[model samples]
Target: MKMSREQKYRLIEEAGEEELALLKQQVKQSPWRQKYHIQPSTGLLNDPNGFAYYQGEYHLFYQWFPLGTDHGMKYWYHLKSADLSDWQDCGIGIAPGDPQDSHGAYSGSGLEHEGQLYLMYTGNTRDNNWIRHPYQCMAVMNADGQITKWDQPVIREVPSGYTDHFRDPKVWRAGEQFYCVIGAQRENGTGSIVVYRSPDLAQWEWAGELSTSLTAFGYMWECPDYFEIDGQGVLLFCPQGLQPESDKYRNIYQSGYVIGDRMNMNTLELQHGEFHELDYGFDFYAPQTTEGADGQRIIIGWMGLPDIEYPTDQQGWAHCLTLPRELHLRNGKLLQKPVPALADRRGSKASFSGRFTGRQQVPDFAGEAYELICTYTAEDEQDHVPNEQSAVTAGQASVFGVELRTGENEKTVIGYDAQTQKLTLDRSAAGKPFAESYGTTRSCVLDQPLRQLHIFVDVSSVEIFVNEGEAVFTSRIFPSRGSQGIVFFAENGAVHLQAEKWDYL
Candidate 1:
């Protein structure tokens, strides 16, 4: 029997304990299942949405396609958290069927207005000929958790002189006015950002456009986000179809930012600096951020890139979210550190420190899901102390770092070159290859000495924060269960080190 649209919406919107238990049973049998990450309950998950802290809880929603591992019609799956560490599934928050969002409820953000939660997202529609019409739609979630979609789109149609590529409205309140920035593409085929302002949340007016003839950005931009930090405005967005620029923009798409002292909303002009990639990793895109109740800019990103295949596709599910990170601005760059609340999961901790002359492997340093922190300096440094020793002489490379998943010729390597100031994550041998289009290695350069490395490893993912979050790399890895051994190796010179490991619950 064909299910009516109302029946389908009822089925999805009311999915609760019975649905979750079944999903848990099915997913528990998959070897690639993550223990602590926010993955899809059944099918595919992408692009976290509606990330807002409200009513003493943090609400997060994601683009979900529950019937399969592919991007079919997308729905929004909602979850709430009290501490941002442990989460409760709130079932489906929005279902597609209404005329406004018949095709899908695409990406957007959340805001708290007058004690109610307001969500603004893109409503994606396609004709039989596959022509696209996107709408900037709105909905309200009352204190009782009932979501009511507004009958019509706040911004009814695509504006003049742009393609239907306009979408992903990130809304925020600046003083008494509500402002939004949406990603768009010019008629001439360059990516840009369009600003909109509303005195009240109901009526919106076009502010202006922010684009560049100064540089060749991609043809279209997606998921544009704007915020203020330390009195500076930061614009972050994802650009598609960008040609590789040396060591940057190497992914299928890129997520980056341009810092500006201020943004002229009416003119859409920004006194900004150069663009910089947010993460240098094999898999990271479509990041969304929110300011927490404590005044920290927190961000979470989809742990998988678009148009890529993963081994987990065979297991009936795919993709997850990176751990939530707190963003800070330091020396004109964004610094991202995993929220300290995550430390509550640490159990059975161990500490190690030493002066290592060469290739040295710490005994009992092995786990698939754990957090590792290390501090070290080049051997030539005369001002350092060494404790508890492990020594060997590996010859001339002038680089230092660690190797993970070291078994059966499958290991993911993260290394830093003091001379070049380049940090790289090489996953050539991590495991099953996903796509040739996404190369096996990604790198970033540090503006200062490489003093510390903080790494978090789940069953199939790795997130590295370098030099107190001066730079970060988040990627997924597929390694055999037996490939859990970790080793630290250095070349040419000795290393003064202090390290700690904590197994995660």
Candidate 2:
């Protein structure tokens, strides 16, 4: 058995004055700041934790290493929002509050038991001999969302074959019973998920290991999340150290899901079919899932990759959550669509409804870094105007510009690509629009079924949710200060665009 969290609490210590000073300095100098979305404060942030809803407000907790972004003493950073666009930081919610967690308060989940909020987390510690210790624990929050220290760990360590690399507790309700899933590293260095059952929020009994993987899954599982959606179960996880099998696993790490049958607590076995990544992008990991008021299962992931250089470090801050996505299991695969609640940010009233046509951009509404969705005909290949090798042949993208403003003359651009059936991201278009791959294109499979792009941009990032969110392309773009024009262009053909704009103020 692992040391109880009560026993682990004796090792707590405030990070040294020098250590804390360094953290403050780094917070003031995060490389990703000024150009992208990040938690308002500093420190190292990883994994979206304790995402839950209570009393009508939405809460999002994250694994925060406040001593800069280098994974110092871990804490839980709290945020609350009524709408997804505007978020408020609630400060450190949980920390190395107990001796056993002197090392870190690892990732976990938040649950609503009765009227109170319950937090289940991993109490990570290091012994005098420097061996890693992880104790499974739970904490309760009063009506105010404040934690009353959970003195003891409910499950101390993994069974014999599992190592101390166990954490990331995801809890949910099954009928009248409370169940939890945790990522684990086996003694043999394999990744798997363990299960537990609890009648109330406090007491837990090990149900068994719910799922396991072979060598390809890497040595340890990071964030493990499971939920039922559209009559099917989806298990999401991030497996570390997985070598590329082929063209996949090409990123530094991968966050994906497996569509499976329900977890039979009695058998502790997962009846799974296929596995697919949640997003096909360079930065996405440690995803967390929570249920919405609409009875929808929505997921949010850390959009910053580990070991990757984030240019914003000079400004301070590292990563951010990708836009919230509503998860659905379509044909044995997990499909993520941006939540419908986001479109509510569509300000200035919707225009050009019922479909129309034109060779020009919409009138009266002109702004860069805005959202546009419209369906119209491309005047055909012969209708396009010639410009360099990129001639806009009728019916295709000849000119399109969505910009974001920082200074009087600064913005980012995400344009359309008709020849390649892709969308090009123009991070350099504001000034040096001709930089190498100045306009980066990505496959977006737009046709009759998906003729429009629901675009969202925040100065330095663009998330194009196409076909009502069926397919999504999220990337980071940094435009120069020389251009702030929200311009659009078309060739001889026409396109009817229904545009919406919002200030995330």
Candidate 3:
């Protein structure tokens, strides 16, 4: 059911206690809820915002619409963790009812200064004519975890030459001054990023649009994040209106990054390389990153997209944040690996090692919520002669991989085609289907020989890290409750396989 403007903007306080309780009950009854991922208790969640390590814990917030499973009346829902693995809900960090954020509390970043955490985010307001006016607002959290908003927005007006589509401020300290890069659209409607400099976090000066090679890439860019990794600058953003090209930009909106020499703060110039996607799967967007206390760059993304309806919406809930991933710059490309803290959630373990010629299911290797690490080494053709007992003639496997969440009539295949050297994820029959027009499969060509696959499977989602995060695919699946089987297979030839699985605690 489409929500009217009144319903969409209705505050949670306006709802009766019975109504709120019923909504929570409906969400609790949903079968697709994730086992370990951070999700909203009820309503919609998107855009991981205000993620930072503060005091003695990691504090993360997301854009939340508490009343329903639609993009409406957003609040900054909060969660904190000493270790990224176990999160404690803090509830409603920033409610949107003030004049600055009358419509919603949008996305932003977190910075720790002088004993407190400063939360800077976009304050979304709609005028009487339904025109959007975004404000860069700030809120402070003390050691006691009390959050207080500023009486006025730090940035009240959209700088000239950009439209109201401007939002998502990513702030960082560079030397002695703080810098911020915000996603914006030019007056002519093309996506761009503008810079700002703040000396004390109270007064900010417009630093001008960031200079880059991408002059006309997309219509609008959202959630721009800039950071330096290993002396190289990487800018990550979600650009809307990107047309599909070959196997890239297949999603309705695209999130990716460009890596190059560190930006020249004096000139605000970013001489970066071509943009490369951060995740090549069905559900990933608005990813935000923060440097951990150990100096590791870690990221978490909304495991869902905007304007897309999911099977869980009928249950009065939607979406979750992906498991935290540690980012690294290897050979000019970003490599993402699930953080080591996630291992804290590992329960019972299973192991398998052998030459698998065809589809085989090992005992204790099947589950809906677990982590699997498998390596397939194509056997040398000269070593294995053709035999009637073998599945195919003597040669390396032409195609190989695993099937997840398999049932009698459904399975999600993550396979690698040796002939084309392409890694593909096919969820055409994984389960309940939506967005079929965008296609049900996604693939990325591998530059090196296929080696290992590290997979994290939750009740309703899967995060695949290939070859130690040289490539990654994050997607959500809606398989039936009974589809908990997993199978490994090789086609046309046999391959040496070593596998291990750990059920999530």
Candidate 4:
């Protein structure tokens, strides 16, 4: 709904000279406004804030700056979904209209108490000396959905030795007392999580810090979530300052967790020394967790990185959330799969069993929008002949390729980069104007060996979840009219393919 005249005037009255300038700057900065791409109606958006499951629905609130592309005062943007795939955007939930949150209502989490939805977030503010201060606060919506916030900040401040960087509180109920973790920076200039205990959800008592390892992993950690997955505990967070570490940290920051043994609640101990990647993809970060109604530990994340320049920003919007993932411990490694409910939206099966030798130029079945899974491996051990490079030939990438094509106007070529020994995706062959607009080339190097590309392509968007959740590449392509037929090429290779089509109606 558009804002009423009265509402607009009220907004104007609420602003000062600086706020007015900032608002004008945000509106002026957009080169484009990306539609249906989950963007702020106005300013900048970052992490998904205040996420939880309630009333048979998954409610996800994100950082929203609806007036512009700048990271101005944030409001909690609301969306809820019953099946995790079809989402209902509920507009702004908690806004920065409150005086206590005049600066910005930063990142946090959501919970339900006494049949009421309660939100806890960092109340960001600047004091007289321009020092950053954070506060934990609460808000609730009545049964009718009319929202109201408490007058005072629930948890006023953290103890000394931790600077104003303390924020992004992730709260959960353990046994009876409510426990929460806040990202903090020590006086020594390192990052940590401070655990706190709150009995009534209002007042909080500071517990101790989690770790002071300072092992050079990353600077301040953001969005810390602790939960038990498959009888074991997992601590998930996005650590800042993490640089490229071999096959990891390829993106700006990382979204991952450490599986550990949970100690006493008051002590806040995690008895594990290892960290793992949450999703090895071009975009994924700031993951949060919630226990599903089915007793499964489910997770969701904000998919765009901070500080990295986004092409979409030119379109007057930025960022999106990753599909919800079900996390599990498999074979001593973390495993993730798209939530099952997404399959319900798969419409119909556009697939059939066929021996794909890549020689078959026909796609068997094709659609402007489709979901296809193609699997491949060496036809035999003898066929695993590596390229003549002394390195990859010395290691791997000696596998086969199962290529995909659409028409002279559109096609996607994919194969392993033999020299790098990494799986690669190619859209170089997606021809014509679409090819020219997209420059017809894209790819992502897989962390592990992937023998398949489980592709989900909507009319304009392509999301390739590689090898059953190992890695993903998401890209957008606009094609000329009447260029929708897809093809498969063996390209001196052989494999099995399943092409699934859906109406998405």
Ranking by TM-score: 3, 1, 4, 2
Estimate the TM-score of every prediction. 0.92, 0.78, 0.97, 0.79
| Lowest-sum lDDT 10-residue window in model 4 | 386-395
For model 3, the run of ten residues with the poorest summed lDDT:
385-394
lDDT of 1 by residue, 1-505 (tens): 2235433333244557776566556666777788799999787899999999999889999999775566766888899998888999999998876888877898999999999999999998777777888999999999888899899999987788889999999999887899999999888898888889998778988877874433458898999899989999898999898889788989999998888776766566778888889998878899999989899999999999877878887666889999999999988889999999999999888787877757778876888999999877443345444332322112324788899878889899999887777899999999777775668899888887678889999989999999889989999998888888888887877777788999999
Determine the C-alpha RMSD for candidate 1 after optimal superposition of all C-alphas. Answer: 4.1
The global Cα lDDT (0 to 1) of model 3 is 0.92
Where model 4 places Cα greater than 4 Å from the true spot, the runs are 1-43, 212-215, 356-369, 377-421, 425-452, 458-462, 470-492
TM-score-superior candidate, 1 or 2 = 1
lDDT by residue (1-505, candidate 4, tens digit) is 2234333323324657776576556645543333224455554577887777788888888887654445656778888878777788788788765656767778888888888778888887776776777888888865555567889998887688887788888889888899888887777766678898889888888888885333456677778888776667778777877777656666666677787677457566677747777755455677777777787877777756766555445444556665677777765556677688767656566555444544454434665555677654433336544222222232223444444436664665556654454765555554322223322344546555555567765544456666676665654444433556665554343444444555443
TM-score, structure 1 vs. true? 0.92
| Candidate 3 ranges with C-alpha deviation above 4 Å | 380-394
Instruction: Give the higher-lDDT candidate: 2 or 3.
Output: 3
Q: Which stretches of candidate 1 lie over 4 Å from their true place?
A: 1-26, 211-215, 378-397
In lDDT terms, which candidate is top? 3
